[model samples]
Target: MPELLTTSGNIALTPATFQHRLLEWYDRHGRKTLPWQQDKAPYRVWVSEIMLQQTQVATVIDYYRRFMARFPDVHALAAASQDEVLHLWTGLGYYARGRNLHKAAQILVERYGGEFPVHSLEAMTALPGIGRSTAGAIIAISTGQRGVILDGNVKRVLARLHAVAGWPGKPAVERELWRLAERYTPDERLDDYSQAIMDLGATLCKRGTPSCLFCPFEDVCLAHAQGEERRFPESKPRKVLPERQTIMLLLRNEEGRLLLEQRPGAGIWGGLWCFPQFDDREALSRWIDAKAPGAILEPAWNSFAHTFSHFRLHIVPQPARCKRTGHVSEVDTLWYDSARPANIGLAAPVKQLLNASRPFAAQPSF
Candidate 1:
C-alpha cells in the first residue's frame, strides 16, 4: 500500500488518491467554456495567462476577447504599435503586463518565427513578463508537456491542504510549496491535471470563503483538520502606504480638444495618455504661461484619491480653456477630441475624468 499522509482524525491521503479525487471533481464541475479553453493554442493560452495575473476571471473575459480579436497571433501582435496594445489593455491595470506582452511578442516573431517554445520552460521564462509559473501554465495547458504551476490560486490551495506556515511570498515557504507541487504532478493527463489543480483552487479552495463541504479534499486537508483553513496561507505583512498629491490640467482648446500628454515609458501609467500633471499650482501656472500663454484657468474641481499598489494619489482636476499655442505642439502631446478620439491608452482615472469633463467642456465658460 502507498504510504498515506494522515490529515483529520480517521481520514488519510496519498498522492494517487489526491490526484484521482481532484481530477474526478474537475471532470464533473471544472470550467470548460472559458474563451481560452475553447482553443488551447499556445499563443491564446499565453495571452490569457498574462491577462489573468492579479485580475479576476470575470473582468479578464471581455479584455481577452477584444485583445484576441485585434491581435490574433504572435505575428500580428508583434507588428502592432505599443499604443494600440496598451489601448486595448486600458482599464486592466498593471500596464507593465501589456508592455511586456508586446515586448515578448516582438521577440517571438524575431527569434522563434512567431512560435512559442512550448517544450522549453527556460526559453519561455527568458521572455519578458513570463515567469516560471506562467511559463509552466502555457506549456501544461496549451500542450501536453509536463509542467508544474504555482500561481496564486494554486499556492492558496497547496498552502491550506498542507497547512503550510509563513507567508507564501517568503522564499522558504515558496520553496516548500514548489517541492510539494513537483512531487504531486502526475505523469499522464498533464493538461487535465494542471487545469484540475488550478480549478480546485479557484472554485472550492477560495481564499476568503472556501466551500469545504464541497471540496474533494475536505476530509484530507490539514487546514480543515485544524479548523483554520484561511490561516494556513499567512498574509503578507502590511505597512502604512505613503500618500502623493498632484494637480492635472484639463486644458480644452477652442475646438474642444483636450490636451493630453503621453507619460514616460517607465514610470506610473507608463505608455498611457494622461492630462498634464504638476506638483503645485505655481508650477501649473508657469506651464500655462509658457505653453498655453492665453489659457484661462478655472477653479479646481473636487479632489479625489487614486490608490496604487504602493501609494495613494490625491488628484485635483484643474480645468482650463485655451487657444492652440505653437509651443504646445509636441510629439509626446496631443489635442484629444472626444468626438474623434485617437486610439490610445488612458489610465482608469484619466478615462473617468474625460467622461466627466464632457459636460464641463459644453459649458459656455470654464
Candidate 2:
C-alpha cells in the first residue's frame, strides 16, 4: 500500500482517506459540464486534449466548437486537406498541434480503421505529435485504462502536493513526479480520478495564487500546512529572450491586389501567407529598388511587436505600390484581393492588419 509522503511529513493515503476527501470536494466543486466532458468518445477526448495544450479552455471553446462542426469525426478530419485544417487552426498558437492532429487523424483512419487503438500506447506515440502524456490521457479517459499522465497542470499539482523541489523540466525531477503519480492513481474509477486530479490542479491548485480555502487536499497538503503553498514547486532561473527586428513590405499592385508569399513549411509562422519580409531595412530597400525600380513608397503604416516564448519580434510595416510584369512563380509570390484573405492562408497577425485596414480601403477618398 503506497502512501502519500510530503517533505514535511509522511501521511498514509488509504483508499478511504483519499477518496472521501478528494471526491467529496470534486462532487461539489469540480468542473462538470465542459464541452469535451459531454462525450467520452476517444476522438472527442483526443481532440480536446490536443487543443488544451498550452491553451486556455476559454480560448479553445469557440475553436473547438468550430473544429468539431467542421471535421465532426476521425474520418472527416483525416479526409480534410492540411491547408484547410491549418486554416481552421489559424489563430491557435503552436501550429504543430493542428498539424499533428491532422496527421494523427490520417493514421487512425488508415492504421486503425478510423477508431483509436485500445491500450496501444506505442501505436499512439508513433503518431506525429501524440506524446506519452497525450496518449496516456486518451487511453485513461476514453477507455478507463490505467496509464501515467504528466501534463503541466498535473505536474504543478503533484509537485506541490509532494513538495517535489528542483525544476520539473529536469529528468530526475520528472521521474520522481511520475513515480508519485503512478503511486497515487487509483485502480478503479481511473478515468474519473484522472479528470478529478486535472480539475483540482486547473481550478484550485493554479500556478500563481492557488485557491487553498476551497481545495479539498488543503488538510493534508504539506505546502499548505507549512504556509508555503506557492513555494513548493521551486522556480527555475530565467533567461532573457533575444530581440529580433524585421521589415515587412506591404505592396499592392494596380488592381487593388496585395502581393504576398507563402512561408516555407518550417520555422516561425510556417505555411502562412505574409508580405515579403527582410531582416533589415537596408536589405528591404535594396530588394525593392532592384526588383521594382521607381516604385512609390508610402509612409510606414504600423509598428508592432509579437513575442513568442523564446524570442521577441519587432516588425515595421512599410506600404509600397509596385508594377511588375515578370514571372512570380519563381519567388512564391501571389496577388489576391485583400478583402478575401481567407482564400489564401494568411497568418493571424497579417490577417489582423488586413482586416483593420479593410474599412479604409473600402471607402474611396481621393
Candidate 3:
C-alpha cells in the first residue's frame, strides 16, 4: 500500500504504516537511554513495567536502579526475604507491587527455575501482579513477539490516535482498544514498535498540555484533528475519597533507636514497617502503659493528613522517650536504628515523619 503523508511530512497512521512511522520517529527521537532499555531481558522488562504502573518514568528511574542493584535477577530476588524486598521498595508507593513482585519471583524460582517464563504471555500473566498489558510488554520488548500492550501511556496515545470514545476502563471501550492494539502491532520490529508507541505516549501525548505539533502522528491523530485530545481518553467516574484519623507513635529508646512494627500483609502499608498506630489518645496511652512501663511521653505534635488512593489519614504523632530497658520484644516489632538504614523497609509517611522529628530524638522538649 502507498504511504499517505501530509504537507508537513508526517505520515497518516494506518494499520499498515503506523509501525513504520512510529518506529522511524522512535529511531530518531525516542528515549532509549532508560536503564531497562540497555538490556532487553524479560526480567528487566517485567520489573520496569511493574514499576512504571501509575508512576512517572522520572520517578521510577532511581527506584528501578536501586531495586535492580539489590536484586540483580530472579534468583537473587527469590532467595531474599520479603522484609528485604519491601525495604528496597520502601519509598516506592503502591507497595503491593513490591510484595507481588516478591511473590511472583518465588513462584518463578520454584516453577521455572529462577527465570521469567518468557515462552508465553499467558504464563507470565498467571503470576502475581502481571496483567495482560504487562505480560505483553515483557514478551514483546524482550523477545520481539507481536504482543500488544495498553498501559496508561499507550492507552492515551491510542485513544487520541484513534479518537476512541468513552472511558478506557469501561468494558466495551477497553475491548475496542485491545482490538485496535492487536491490529496495529506489527509483525516485524515488534520490540521497537512497542517501545516507540509507549515513548510517544509518555513524551508527546501527555495527560496535560500534549505537544501535538511534535507528534509523529500529528496529521493522523483523530483527537488532535478535532482539537479534543484530552476528550478521547475519558476520565474515570469520580467518587469521594473517605477520610480517617489515627495516632502514630514515634517512640525512641535511650540507644536512639525508633520503635517500628511490621504491618500485617493485607491492608494499607502491608508488610511494611511503621510506628504503632492508634485510633485515639486513650488507646495509645493504654498500650504505652502496658508496653513501656517507665516511658516518658513528649508533647504531642499536631495532627497532619496523608492522603491515600481511597482515604485521607489524619495522623497524630506522639513521640516518647523510653527509659525502660525491660520491655518485651514482639516478634515483628523492633527498635530500628535509622543509622543502619538498610535493615528494614519503612512506609513513606513513617520515613518522612521520622526525618522531620530528628531534632527531638529521644530527649523530651520543654
Candidate 4:
C-alpha cells in the first residue's frame, strides 16, 4: 500500500486528510525562512506576493528588502512620488505592477488609513492590483485567517495531484481549482498550511522535472501514479507573439544631457521614462523635422530587440544633436544629464540602448 493511502488513520485520502500529511511534510522539510515570512505583515506579504507574480523568488529577495527599507510601510509608499516608487523598482519588469502598487498604496491610505484592510478580503481586493488570490495570500499568511489561494504554484500542485485536464486559465479549470483549494484549506494552522502548500509546489512540484519523490502526495498523485506528471497541468493554447517596430530618438544637447520623456499612463512601458519613440525611419524624420528642425540625425550601430511576454519590440536607435534647445507641447519631457544617471524609472529597453550607445556616442562609425 502507498504511504499516503495508509496514513490519515485509515480514512480515505481526502483534502482534510491530505492536509495532515502536507503539514507534517512541511514541518519536517517545507520552506519556512523566506524573507516575506520573516516579517509576516500584511503590507509586506502584499508587496512580496505582487512582486512574485511573473517573477522568481531569488530575483525578488533583494528587490523586496530594498523596497521595504525605502518605503517601510503603506504610508511611506503612498507619500512617495510615483517616480520614486518606480525608481526603486527598476529592472523588475512589468512596470504596470509598480504603477498599480503605487496607486493601491494611495488608495489604501485614503480609505483604510494605510492599514492594509486586514480581515476583509473584499476591501483589499477593491484596491488596484490586489486580486482575489493576492488578497487571500495577504489575509491568510499574515493574519492567520483561513483563505484559499490558487496562485500558479498551488495550481500546478493541485492540477498534478488530481490530473486536472486543460489550462488553469480556463474558467472551468479555475472553478475546479478554487473548489479544490477550498477543500484542501484547513481552519487550523492557516498561515503555515498556506505557506506549506505554496512551498511544496515551488520547491518540489515545479513546472518541469518535479521532485515527486519528495512530495507529500507522492503516493496518491494521480499524475505520478500514471507517469504523466509533466502532462497533467496542461499548458495554455499557444499563439505566436506579435512583433512591434519602433525608432527611438537618442538626442543629446550641448551639455551632453539626453532627452527623455515620461510615457502616458497606458500602453507599453506605461508610467515609465523612455526616449521619444516613432513608428519607423519616416516617422522619426518627420518628428525631427517638426520638433528639432536643425537637428543632425545619425543611425546608431545595430538595432536592439526587446521581447515582452506578449510581443517582440524591434528598436532602431537614432542618435541626434539638436542645434538649439526646444520644448515639446505634448508630454512631460526632460533633458537628463547622461554623465549622471537620473534617479527615475527607465524602461529596460531604453536603459539597455542608452548604456550600450553612450561610450560610442562621440566616436560613432556612422
Identify the leading candidate in terms of lDDT.
1
| Model 3 TM-score relative to the real fold | 0.92
In angstroms, give how far residue 189 of model 3 lies from its true place.
0.8
Ranking by lDDT: 1, 3, 4, 2
Better of 3 and 4 by lDDT: 3
Please tell me which model should have the higher TM-score, number 1 or number 3: 1
lDDT score at residue 158, model 3, on the 0-100 scale: 81
RMSD of each: 2.8, 3.5, 3.6, 3.1
Give the poorly placed runs of model 1, Cα more than 4 Å off.
1-12, 360-366
Tens-digit lDDT track for model 4 on 1-366?
556553322335677778999999999988878889898978899999999988999999999999999999999999999988888888998888999999999988898787888777788888889888888888889999877788999999988888889998899999998888988899988899988899888889999899988777887788887788999689988799899988888888777778889998788778888999989788887888888888888756567688988888888788888866764435578887767887788898787767765755653422
Report the lDDT of model 2 for residue 255. 68
Off by over 4 Å in 3: 1-13, 359-366
User: What is the Cα-based lDDT of residue 8 in candidate 2?
Assistant: 43
Total clashing residue pairs per candidate? 0, 0, 0, 0
Pairs clashing in candidate 1? none
lDDT of 3 at 167: 96
Please give the lDDT score at residue 62 for candidate 1: 100
Clashing pairs in 4: none
TM-score of 2: 0.91
lDDT of 1 by residue, 1-366 (tens): 332444433235667887899899999999989999999999999999999999999999999999999999999999999999999999999999999999999999999999998878899999999999999889988887888999988899889888889999999999999988987788777789888898888888998999999998887788988899979799999999999999999999888889999999988899999999999999998998888899999888888899998999999999999866566988999989888868899999898888888754543322
Task: State the number of backbone clashes in model 4.
Answer: 0
